[model samples]
Target: MKKLFIILILTGLIYVTYLNKEIFYKYPEAVRYTLKNSNELQRAEFEKVLKYFNKEEDNLKLKCAQVLISNIPLYSYKKEPETFNQVVDSIHALKNKLIIYSDSLKYNKRMLKKVQDLFVDKMNFLCKTNDFFDKEEVRDIDTLSSSFLIENINLAFEAHYKLPKKYRTNFNDFCNYVLPYRNDREPLEFQKRRELYEKYSWVYDSIKIKPLEDIVIQIYDDLKINIDFKKLSNLNLSPTPSQIEKLQYGLCRDVTNYFVLLFRSLGFAAGTDYITTYGNRHSPIGHNWFFIMYDDTFLPIQARSKSLIFSDIEKIFKLTNMPKVYRNVFNKINFKNSSINIDTDVTNMYRPTSTVQIENIFQTSNKEDFKLCVFNKKSNWFEVDKNFKLNNNKVTFNNVGRGIAYAVTNSFLEPINYPFYLDYKGNLMFLKNKNLKEDIPFNITRKYPPIDLPNKWKIDRIKALNNCKLQGSNYLDENSFKDIYTIKNFCSTQKSQFLFKKEEKYRYYRLIAEEVTSYTSYIAEFALINTDLEPIKNVKIDFYGTKESKLKQKSKITDNDPLTFGRFLNMKITFEVENNQNVSGFEIQARNDDNHINIGEEYELKVFDKAWKRVRKEKAKDTVLNYKSLAKDGLYILHNLTKGKEETVFTFDENGNQFWFGVSDVNDLGVGAPMSMGFK
Candidate 1:
């Protein structure tokens, strides 16, 4: 009788196990396979998470089971038993956290429904594509990956539980929009990248202990302290937490990624908002900043302590031409037509005004109906307004609020990549005439050789001559002159003025770069002026420099000149001289001080051979040091032995023989230049 009873009990136990096979099955082989590949930290973390899940309530486990069974479909996992089991375990682990956190808030049913809907929507997007996976049986592996689903689940629960009670109903439906992990790059398996975030859990824990406002402040402070902003190569690869922590430096995008991931790991809603490029010509690159949901309001957090105002963000960054601004989200945005390729990852913009006009549509017909779709970041693309229709292949989207949006036809869609900001007048202004003549003003300043001239070198007339016919090998020869207009004496003071006689046409003009010095003549700011004394519009003015002066040659500047001023050493203007223009008057200003010092009573001058081996020292008798007897290419030094001031001047004489002046100081004590010696 005892043996018969034991046999019956064993049969009953086996029947119960077989009946609930999906929930009871454990893959010892898969566990061992994962353990063999994982490192000590990964194994420890996985076991820790598994243990936590094992402690969850029976009801929570059943809820997870029901969710997977209803949405995942048994047919989807028929062939991939190992992937199915792993996914089931990961989901259970995630749900365990959700139940624990939700229990603290007494479990709102409305929020729970919203969370489930988000999970289903995200899962659908992930499972829709099989291109990333190789095996047919495991095609849905990406959706099941712990990094994708479980991480998102964790985020959804945190957003719902921590969201203020007032916003519970209005925001409950969109909680999942802030949960997914898709960035600028394509969707990737989170399982492989989970270990990276786990390494930085300590950072999340530190912030989690603080109050809401304190938490935000702590996050900003911690990031500022830890991450240094440095551009890195191989930006295509999204960096792991360990990599970012070790490198300690990254670009704006890389740093923003780090900030978002760090916040998301701790269950805080964070994302990046950026301009593709600045509208203002002053800035050539785009900019990105952290956007955090704080106190039920979206605020832009910068590296500084002060909070950034949305309107001022445009002005502060000098954004003039924002083609499209994008706010990043984690979930996939599905448009009405799959055939139309739109960049769905970009969903939010920072537009605060009505300046962005959507125009220039190249459609088959102007009368065809079109819709402007704006992404809500939740799940669907909401239409802007029915009034926005295509008229003459254009439509102006005025006062368009901040979001990722596109203009679409039944069969086509075009993404608005840049977010346009309104000018002071509250109108979307196209960047037309970036090169308008009114924008650039006339500027004439002294050039080189003699950057400063003595006040005594006075000339009666400065000529505006043009229509040059060049003499052989010399454009400034006496034969090159065709027409010359000599104005009365104006080159006496530092600033001089001249007026062009009425109705003069000129292809070339000449102006003094510097006053006549013993060594060379320097010139700059040669321009063709209009009757209003403004620079003539759009004329290519070519500049040439030479040691020779046109005054001595009794000729005009030539067109085929070879010598051009080095941009770094001197400023040269290059505008085409406008013909048949009359100048009211023109002004020329010399440099404040001649870069070349007069040596007069300041210091004693010395000359050395090119090698600096042979030295010829001389005492300055007057303000100026005469170098007529010195060899060309000689090294020169200025010494104020009394004041312990000594420096080597690097200048060469023309033709191996000429006087050179000191322009700047030098030091030979440490690396290359000379240094100062304190007076004893």
Candidate 2:
């Protein structure tokens, strides 16, 4: 039973590590396309919330971390294995629900990959089933588990071999192409990454993140501060992740790549979106901005800056911008005119990029009018034998059909968001530009989805900003939760050593320590403040130092909304430890409000332990000075430093309980603050 439990635990941890590695790697094509397309385009009104599916990396990671810890069984073989089975059932239910709604659009390409779909479904089942193999797992259960694990691991590889055909990465060139750009040049780390195929074969092969944010979220959580180069690189455009890693500041594409890379390193899923103006016979060449979803909320991430962007990317695909666009939809339009056939062969008629093409005067008469006529894509403008005026800049027909053509031109750019979603197959394929839909409507469908998909939630994305704001908090940020270290994680049964630096000089310094209180109750949030002093910025920071301190017991630094002079800068803490251990808290606080000013005078308060030897920082010189106490039984101390000078100072006492005058140490005094205090 013990052996079974140990193996299950180790296996689970190993699987988690495998998942993290995949999250940490970023593909280059995904980098460029996501930045240029996703950033520049606006999404439909749907604000999605399933974090992993959202593609905002931080949100996805948070969701993933929560799931990895939530309701997990203590042992696989426990008598009530039903509890374990229930958790597995819930995860599978979530996964299936994702499929139906994630690609709920009428024309989703996600439904196209049949073999891929089945493979993923099977893999999900095997993974969920693996969670049930605990100590109560008997020989029959062991046989079933072993068969499932081995069979799926092998089956996963066969699906892997077909990925090159699906995603376009030639198996051999892929790794070699990415190898040189990795963040760390260490040989072993490179090998571990390069040999990623053997470790988790399916990840390096087969699969893609639609909308992009979902993938980025998973990667961000796993990598956290340990982000790598591949995530921020564009192998197709920049051709190397190293270029992105080496850059300090960059353009919209560069910033986009950096963010996507960072998110992937932390173990979140992500999706991408790009844009291009029409090019001669091809699609758009020029394009603009970005959007991502994470933590169940969509983010119109600014691919251009560290800041976030609001809904600004025009979701329009311009056919007029195409260099040589065909004007043939008119060939299919039916007209009421018997002589001027609307179905006339205008197949060769096309538009130009350099100059406007027009049939100026095919008629013989100017005003006396040899003939009156018009042509339009909607076929409603083919009216003949009608009173029409043709001037240098004005062409008007008495009928309203001419006005309809103008409206169609403007409507092309107003298409719905989902039709432009990254995985959408439905797009505007214009037959003619500027012809106006005299009869036919523009090839645009601006409709809403029936549902928000998976779930509906308010995700904080960058809202429109006014010009006057100083700038702060977006809906997303970073976390510092590293996985728990155990015997297998660490080579030896030992605590990790951490060296903290108190980088800034301050007026006061103090270290604090506290104990762990409950099961799975790690530090959720922590912050040091200037509770008794004035506020200053950019002071050196570090937690307290105590050799006996446990790693999991130490408070973690976070960037979500935590206590700070500025906007919300941190969220949850990363500290964790067993509740059974006797533990104490550790914090290093320092204040140097006068670092930029001259200190002329200072004062100090001294609390004494009954023992004469108990004095704080005893190495300083002792000065002879007047001593006083609020009362004989209350407290007593001496005022230090000369009068009429403002100087930064520190206060500390050896609390065994003897009071003393700091007359010997000139460094221990403040001018006006000491004498007025009464013993409490």
Candidate 3:
């Protein structure tokens, strides 16, 4: 009787195990590893997805599921309204209002300001309501539903198989590039990926018969019209496809993310490439763009531009200077130097690169490894490239971009030595101070490089100054003016001088605009100078212009503020000097970034020996700052003590021109001519 009872109990235990077979099923090693890290509920949800795929007999999609499941644990999204349905509706309402205002020429500045204020208020309200927008990272493994995962896998495979044979990528490539449900912090809502596919798939349909490049170009062109790229906050928020479609305002990274998702939605393999910092310290902010795969090769496209040919992209890179560039992939892989698991170095493929070797002064043994870093902020260094091993008392970093300042550091980012920069020819130039006792004369003009806009410098503002006349008159009448000087060429400098001897004593002087284009013109600051080349103080000035230009206060031309400009089609300014005998020349300042040194603003100068040491602190009495002699071959930085944060390190050339070390070393940045420093 006891043996029979034991047999019955064993049978009951076997039945219970068989009943829960699907729940305890095994997955691939990588997928199982992620599952092990997940909670019981998360594991059950993933198991349900696997069982559904297995029962359907969809082996291809089942493999894609494994790829996504293995990497999804690391991905998360912000629990914000950027992906919600209500946000899209709100954006559309605001966009409609914008369209109405933009369509009307009768709208005045007041009306425009009203619209802008409304937009700002709406955005602020939306941002403030969501504390989780930047505060929380909601993991997909914890929140993702089984149905969402299954559908994403199905749609990705469907799109991949739909592509033409020539444009189609291998399974591995598709899985790594196009199959991921989410990249970065994009939203992980149910049916979001499929919704994106359904919406943008039309862009591919009309151009399907065309070559892959043409179709890709058309898609980009259409998207650009629909999505408005803006210089929004540099918060690195990855806008969801829905947000991009509705709001149409995003930064470079946000736009790049949108482009990648749009391309992947239509069955094309696409990804993002970015730099955390530029080679030049003047513009420390980084940039990102999208790339598409064609014939086993990926081609990059600019984020805010129209579709560019492959050659155009290459040419842009040849002119661009970057310390490091990284590509984002779906696979759970990481470089030794980077903590990001999805990044791969692609700097060499974009620009001229070199292998860097430096003495391993900090290394205690051959087993020691180090990080190469770039200057980021005031005394801050950011790690880049790959982690290098120490060998033979030397550390080597490969595929380093040229024309950038670099330093060596441990994992904690503690610097081992003073920073050094790479020249355009891929040579290292050290920054150690050779003469600490001696000071150097420093003349600073701009704290930051002027913002580069296409056709802005040479074409719009400068070209408007062509044939502009400077005149002197003993009388206030315009007819009494005699031409002192006529600008024959574009004045490239923001602050330019037109000097001539005042042969005749003139009480009145006037600067007149000539050959102006319909393109809006502006004059920031204007001044009359004495024979000694000093500005005549307390001069009474008045402005006259065409009727259209009269709407604006033309007095802004002499406002003494570079940012406050008088916009005009045609205008003239007349000033009466108390004495005409001293009049010699006049000065003109164009509309600029206000980066030039301002009189009365305090400045601090520092040079790096072992660390940054203050050399002098004083207020600027002139447009330029003249200091004592500087230490030879030292790294120097100038800071605006009063305001602003865009200062950078620089050295002086033979002519005392500010040679921005990293900026000018790049070939086509058009900043300043490189100096022939006596370094090989």
- lDDT to native, each model: 0.37, 0.25, 0.67
Better of 1 and 2 by lDDT: 1
Give me the candidate number with maximum lDDT. Answer: 3
If candidate 1 were superposed on the true structure by all CA atoms, what would the RMSD be?
A: 26.8
lDDT of 2 by residue, 369-478 (tens): 32222212122112222233556522332211110111111012211110000001112212221122222221100011111111111011001000111111111222
Better of 1 and 3 by lDDT: 3
As a TM-score, model 3 comes out at 0.79
Q: Per-residue error at 252 for model 2, in Å?
A: 3.9
CA-only RMSD, every prediction: 26.8, 33.8, 5.9
Top candidate on TM-score is 3
Candidate 1 lands at a TM-score of: 0.35
Return the candidate ranking by lDDT, descending: 3, 1, 2
The C-alpha local distance difference test score for the whole of candidate 2 amounts to: 0.25
After aligning candidate 3 to the native by TM-score, how far in Å is the CA of 110 from where it should be? Answer: 14
